[model samples]
Target: MNAQAPHRQRKSWIIWSLVTMGLALFVGANAHLAYVAFASQPDCVSHSKGSGEAHDYRAAKSAC
Candidate 1:
């Protein structure tokens, strides 16, 4: 019984360590994605003309 205590404690420590590492990785990846989204600027391309047709859709506002 006493010998099992150390083994169980070691296993619990390993599980908690893995969980912490996984959370850190998740947060780091999201932070990197957010940084890229904010840091990069993409040029806008022209779209098809609306021509006031029902099928055609126009942007509410143009960025270019």
Candidate 2:
């Protein structure tokens, strides 16, 4: 059982390492997406002038 101790510890360490790396990747991707969302400014397009129109696109309140 003593010889198996090191092997089990190594496996546990590998598993934890993989989990940490995956978590880091997920957090990094979310951060990048948030940065892009805040940094990018989209140009306004033509939209419906009147309200209560069917199948029409409405501009946002903060639209430029």
Range of the 10 consecutive residues with the lowest summed lDDT in candidate 2:
55-64
Write one digit per residue (lDDT tens) for candidate 2, span 1-64. Answer: 5999999999999999999999999999999999999999889877676677687767657465
TM-score of each: 0.81, 0.83
Report lDDT (CA) for all predictions. 0.90, 0.88
Residue by residue across 1-64, what tens digits does model 1's lDDT show?
5989999999999999999999999999999999999999988878755788778876778788
lDDT for 27 (candidate 1): 100
User: How much lDDT does candidate 1 score?
Assistant: 0.90
Those runs of model 2 whose alpha carbons end farther than 4 Å from true positions after fitting are none
Poorest 10 consecutive residues by lDDT, candidate 1 = 45-54
